[model samples]
Target: MTGLPMEFRAEGLPDRVTIYEVGPRDGLQNEKTVVPVETKALLVSRLAAAGLTAVESTSFVHPTWVPQLADAEDLLTRLDRAPGVRYPVLVPNERGLDRAMAHGVTEIAIFGSATETFARRNLNRSLDASIEMFTPVVTRATEAGIRVRAYLSMCFGDPWEGPVPVEQVVRTGVRLLDLGCAELSLGDTIGAGTPGHVTTLLTGFAAAGVGPERLAVHFHDTYGQALVNTLAALRAGVTVVDASAGGIGGCPYARSATGNLATEDLVWMLNGLGIATGVDLGALVTTSVWLAGELGRPSPSRVVQALSKEQEPDHAQA
Candidate 1:
């Protein structure tokens, strides 16, 4: 596998899959303990050094809403931004966008929901109203020459609303794209998605004239189906995936949510399949292990756990 082209072609999959690292932002936001700003900055630097090209650095939400990321501006300012790496921050509304713009952010993300229940719970608005809220944010970001990525939550299934209709998801996603979002990240917020469900949703999007090139898949491993669903998306021609370091993230408002798909785990599978992600799995595992220490717990990522276990004997021998 060594020396294989970083952009090798794979049947039924893109030549490369862009792994959007969401660890510094999403992963840390939901932690019970507050991670120091210095540590968060170090994590972002380490991730970029490990060959992650696009990392979601932080969110610009109010401190009262997400106290964990209250230092978003400070963190961004402290980062030693790696050349060729893109750091996109999450902006919930126009106000968040204003804050991001002040820091000269070049890329940002806006979030919406496919189900009304989750929309109300997460964004404090109805489904339609949430889209209305993000329209101006997306518009302003685009006008400022910033690339905007939109995240549509609960695309697969909603805990309170049960199974979500595929049509509804497509409608919300299309609206975001129409509002000037460069890409849409369909989120399986509750991790209730299966391979079949993923295929169905992608197919629905296709029918709605939304191709995979403009879409990314974000999955959680609550039921251990994230990777499987990811495979289904790959088969459907999606080349972008959103994952977190150490698989440490969940929606604070969604009671049934769990940690996201680990970047190490996703890279391990992609490496085995000869897929190019430009990510160093061993380095990512090390980063996750260090982050787990910061959180005072073992990483939830299977790849990180197994790799750390494998290194124990070598350390003991030394």
Candidate 2:
């Protein structure tokens, strides 16, 4: 199959895709080492420069729980934000949203769970109670002219309950979107989804009158189906996909959850498909390699691992 690569546009896929970069927040959150605030700031800048429009900068979860992002305020303060880029942050509750508001945050995300077990385990509340909590958060954020995104975890499967129903996911997701969220990111928290499952779920959403334009898919690569499932999603008309640089983060609460669909891998596939992502693949690979050095682990991204080797001797090991 090859000399120099060629481009081919597949049928039924969006011509341009918006990558929701989650590496800075989700990727580093699970790391044992507390990445220096400066390093975090640099990572955000590099990702923006690499042309990701939406880079999730950090989370404002309570320090006692997610200690790694305790320096959220500092990270936000230090970032010299790139123009035309949106650096969104995760605000778990009203207090977190208050802190974000103080920092002049323009975009924020609130994550909820599709299953009752995950709602209790991850959010410390029942599914309905969590929605009760997000109601005011979304209301106030919208009133302040801020944009809010909702994350519905355990969309495909739950560690404790297992095999979540599509209708249940639809109901939970609609609740979040109904609360004034601009979009809803469906999370396969355990990476338990297949291509057929993806089609069925998107169908469920469509039946509920939630079109693909207002939906995003966030898949974990635990079962090696992330990319395939993503293809299924795109075919189902999803233009927004979530990925983390170097594939560094996983669900800290869900033991079996693994790294996200790596940004480099997603970019490579999207590039080969002739879809416009506005990302400089070479620059993104370089940034991810540098981040791997800071984390003291090699990237799980196949593209980064291959390209960095050809970049330079030091970069390959970085």
Candidate 3:
């Protein structure tokens, strides 16, 4: 591990940041190639070994919508759930939640959109109707002693709707919270967010009584601003950030959107800033390299690339 610069050490950042690893679930869901259930289980184990306390294992959405994760039940059943580790899965509706419950799932996530077009296109319903749909799911899960994390996607910009208003994001987020979600993850699904936009939205969240403690920021690297936006969120007192190993997954609905913020990249920044994430940067880079090979591609993470290069034996010196 590297030491933090003196200047950054005094930046008043959180002493520890919670990295919610989404590699096995969100990261693999958009892959054109089919990933075996065993590989997904191994990915979850590797993430836990790398000190990721929270790993999203899979989603229970209908296979028709996300064929890649059709093996959600098999993957979850085969996962090696480590002590003190969480493997939350995405439950799209009542049916998904029931399937997750049948497998003894303790944590689950539900997703909504900040824009009407995205809501209709993604969930086949209007913004208000989608929230109503989630009400039963969230209520039932909470009653079952399951923790729920709600994701509000396209919080910054929508592919069809253009820029989304900050107020609308706040209002939707508040509604999700009211429906019994334990935490809300604001997503930059299109990666259209800048540091200024992040700051402004978080400010609105603060005014709406949604403090940083109950919020997580999920950003994509479509525009290469994910890390900058993450930094801005961190500085604003947000501690939980969502990332994918190897930068593998993207929104299948948003054609222009690319891979998510890489776990290795986020750890590099947090580690350098003296923020404890309990993750081993070298181990995480190695995981991404392995996963990239499985997907027959190179990792999109800049940190992973740099670290892999550094680890290569120097034939010139030899």
Candidate 4:
């Protein structure tokens, strides 16, 4: 009960797993310093070269809210988009979707919280009202032939509401799926979840006829349990995971929440488990090192730190 109920091992597992790269969007969004537009584009291009199939390029939210991503339009417009990959942007409303469409976005993501308290605290609306507002956004995006992914935030727990109800999470997820969401990302916004909690939730979804294939896991590393929960999910048949590079971002309103699991850390685990991520770990580490330097802090990834130490020469030997 303290951690994973049982120690799980990933041996002879599937050769490949899909990683939804959210560095360019989620990682950079919470950066205190505003990353230059050119730098943002470079990050996306590098991620593409590193073999990520889905790169969340940016959020189309208002600049007044997230000034770090104020250049979303510019970055999207100037990207040297890679073939055979999808770049999706976070669109909170019709205006955000319109802006994304103008930039030639082929895929967009709409997000809502599972609990009314979380919705009101983060978006200033009730849970029912928030869903009502996004129905049209999803409808128009579908009509325009753009794939939409729905994000169900605080599925695990919330800062204001505390432990979110499974029924509430299911209700919201069903609505989004009914609205034609290609996939639903269940977010542990506060990083207060454990493997047992995750299994309970996934089991509930499965019993409700929602398989793991249609679901993605988005975990924060607030308590360093993201990877632990991920291992649990994979054993349960989930293949898609959302991670950020350098462990760089968290929700502004979710107190005490850290960033998403580091891409390098997740990749290391997946690769070790024989999961095919198609990502280059060396390149990912390099990118994490560069971004951590830019952020003026050491990376939050334990794997990166260990790797860095191993590569360093023992000057004390002299």
Candidate 1: TM-score?
0.95
* lDDT per residue as tens, model 4, 1-318: 111123244663545678999989988888888998988898899888888999999999888888999999889878998898999999988999889888889999988999988889777899888888898899999999999999999999988778898888988898888888899998999999999999988998898889998999999988889999988888788888999887778887675788899988888887666667888877777777777777789998877777766667889995
Distance (Å) between predicted and true CA of 259, model 1? Answer: 0.5
Candidate 2: list runs displaced more than 4 Å.
Answer: 1-5, 312-318
Q: TM-scores of the models, in the given order? A: 0.95, 0.97, 0.97, 0.94
Q: What is the lDDT of residue 267 in candidate 3?
A: 85
Model 1 scores a C-alpha lDDT of 0.91
lDDT of 1 at 107: 100
Query: Which scores greater on TM-score, model 1 or model 4?
Result: 1
Best by lDDT: 2
Off by over 4 Å in 4: 1-13
Q: Please estimate how well model 3 matches the true structure, expressed as its whole-model Cα lDDT.
A: 0.91
lDDT tens per residue, model 1, 188-274:
999999999899999999999999999999999999999999989999999999999999998888878999999988898788678
Candidates' C-alpha lDDT? 0.91, 0.93, 0.91, 0.86
Model 2 worst lDDT window (10 residues) = 1-10
